[model samples]
Target chain A: MNAILECKGLTKSYGGKKALSDVNLTIERGRIVGLLGPNGSGKTTLIKLANALLTPTSGEIRIAGMKPGTGTKKIVSYLPERNYLNDWMRVHDIIGLFRDFYGDFRPDKAYDMLKRLNINPNDKLKTMSKGTKEKVQLILVMSREAELYLLDEPIGGVDPAARDYILETIISNYNPEATIIISTHLISDVEKILDHVIFIREGQVVLSSSVDEIREQGKSVDGLFREVFRC
Target chain B: MLGKLLKYELKATGRTFMPIYAAMLIAAAVTKLISALTAGGSEVPEFISAIVYIMILMGMFVMTFVVMIQRFHKNLLSDEGYLMFTLPVEPWQHIVSKLLISVLWNLGSLVAAFLSIVILTFDEIANRALMLDLFAVIAEFLTIFGPTGSLVVLEIFLAGIATTVFGILLIYASIALGHLSNRHRTMASLGAFLGLTAFAQILFACLTLIPNVRVLQHYMDTLQESLQTSIALFHYVMWFTIGFFTLLSAGYFLITNHILKKRLNLE
Candidate 1:
């Protein structure tokens, strides 16, 4: 079977500045890979490329043996860092949107998640707090039975308690046979759940190894991240 | 997928349009009532209501234009783009869905405006006769060409639709071109629109300068010579106009789609 994602000499540049350069990597299936990086470290760019939001400047990247496109989008459930929901829609209306577009979306799963979070189905997004909106977004993303889940900064802006809930939701809800590439800077928070860690700095992959390998070498992923990315 | 995209597009844009249409009808009803109650007395309320009705009719069109621009920009090119572009649909489906919905709302507002006017004058026998006479004149005008007249009328109606689609696609293309720039996107869009408009006008002007393309005017000049030839020329011109706009709309569609697919910059 093909790796869940593969990149060959993938490079992306904005104007003259390269966001990602010569990025050659592969991510296998069924692993919770932490794509650890700092701000503006091309983590979002890489995620955006995989989602087909932005075209790569050169080379190519593939998802499950197919290029990033409608086919790839079908199986990759993405949770962008920004609030992408419109203010005019209610929670249920958004669920309906997901149901209309994503064949793999589980509306029952989405409603259950919303119920557990105490988010009313009829509540308008405009009235919801930022944290509540983020939770709702996360719930919608996690409810998809997708083959690959690309979550960009899933815990970046939430409080510690909500962060824990988000993490727990991510752990409990995702498809076990699928892969999850979480792009985040909060290393300590997500370190425990991650089976593999890929350290990216200055738009280049610095380290790609399993968490067990790092632990065997007597270093936590967080400690290694601090050493590699300290300014 | 296009059908689903259009369904959501309608729902999203209808929220802004439906209320205004209802307001227009209500204002028309109030105007009629105020004029009826104060037939020979105070005209102030009637005047105010009439003005309100007119303002709403004008506002509906303005809002239609604003919503068209906003739907394309905000829904497809802003932060919401993350959700939209990631859907398992092609970029052209997004453009076509938005275009279809925008055209639907445009036609809906026109129908509502005409309905509101009819409501304001429904009770007046003179106004009813005037409208019937207008329709009779149009009917008589169509019956002149016999069977060909209906086809001519259909062509004209299609030309109207083609023109509307062309205008919307032009705007889409401008916005897409503007988005390629990293800074001053709105300004770039406006510039692109103005630039495209001027180029089209100049191209048409240059086309008219060619003697071969002056067949439209030649047909008009020879109208007294033969009615049959004039009708044929009319059909030719209408088809040419329809085809011209459809081709242009296709060009604009391709430009917009290419930009959205490969050159998208949703920063």
Candidate 2:
């Protein structure tokens, strides 16, 4: 299988403290990969590096055989940990903006997702609750026919119902041939959709295995996470 | 891409500035009506003229510096920056869009404010045939400056305007830089501003100290000479202004590109 994303000895540091260190990861095409880690485990940092949002301090990262840059960013749809959508924009305007910028953005698909969530097209982002805003952001990201989707904390801070809806939207909307890398601590909720999982601890990759293999080994991904992250 | 970027830039800026432009026109019309009604009615008070001048000057000042910079910063650097940087456009296009928007609005505000003052002082100005003579003299002066001098003067003026826009973009870049950190986004923005201002001031001081750095001084001298021959110094200032802005613009582009490429933290 061809790897859509390959990071070799990736390292990042903030001042003297390291965020990611000597981390190597390879994600193949057509796989839903879970980037599992605790707080400050560098999941977001890794996603940022892959998305070209942050440059690596050292080591190399390649997205679909190209260095992380404008070219790579064009093909990678990123859903950041926090709400990156401007609160001043209405849902329709946000859709328009996405369509304007991303040639592959499917506005009808986005509208369908919004409708499914019962989000009004004319509603301003500021009027929506945080969970709804998150869903809106997710819809925008998933609406793109991108090669790689990097979702950081995709279901964070939402109720169980909203979380299920978000996961459903993601699973239903994503291109089957594309890759999705979801970084989150909510492993139990996301485990079912993930084909592969990488467990990171203190900025290092502690474990990487397919969910089927781990389950065949008579352990749930969450149980394995607890075993690996036990401190 | 540039044309489209600029079109959107202008639209974004216009949304904030159209109201101000309308207000200026209304004020001008009111001033003209008042001046016409009061002309030779009972000897208009000097205080009224002073007030009009002050109002026009105040409006021009706000438009040039406060309104223009604030709008540019808000649209291009604030939270809206996410939308801007992610637009699949180059950093240069972003800088150019903001620069052009600033220049267009600056010129528009100036014209609007001048028209207002003209309306208020129309009687006095018309009685002296100032506008007609000024235009005639300007035409004659342009002929004397010749195409080369005219081009040089134009470049210089554009450079100046470019410099102001570049300065504003640099400020925006600094804010983006500060946001990369985990703490003190506001303080970092302020620090970036102070640091950038100090850096520019020092650079300017150094340039002035150099005897051969004559572009600005030479342009200023030519402008003084041009003014005597009936040409307004506006064009000449704009030429060097463009040059100054071009350099600042380069800096702005570089800094913005670096930030967007490297330390972009959406949160």
The TM-score values for the models, in the order shown, are 0.96, 0.81
Place model 2 in a CAPRI quality band.
acceptable
Top candidate, metric TM-score: 1
Error of 1 at B266 (Å): 1.7
Q: List runs of model 1 lying over 4 Å from the truth.
A: B125-132, B211-226
Residue lDDT tens for model 1, A63-120: 9999988999999999998999999999999999999999999999999988888899
Q: What are the lDDT scores of the predictions, listed in order?
A: 0.91, 0.76
- Position B27, candidate 2: lDDT: 61
| A1-231 per-residue lDDT for model 2 (tens digits) | 568999899998876889999988888899899999999999988887776556678999998988876677688888878766755578998888788778889999999988988999999998999888888888999999999998989899788988998898888877789999999999899989999999988999998899999999999999999998888
* Residues forming the 10-long window of minimal summed lDDT in candidate 2 chain B: B227-236
Q: How far does residue B117 in candidate 2 sit from its true spot (Å)?
A: 2.7
Enumerate the chain B TM-scores of all models: 0.93, 0.69
- Measured with C-alpha atoms, the lDDT of residue A48 in candidate 2 is 73
Cα distance off (Å), candidate 1, residue B61: 0.3
Per-model DockQ against the true two-chain complex: 0.82, 0.33
- Write one digit per residue (lDDT tens) for candidate 2, span B30-100: 65666566767754654465566567557665766765556545655555654565566776677667767
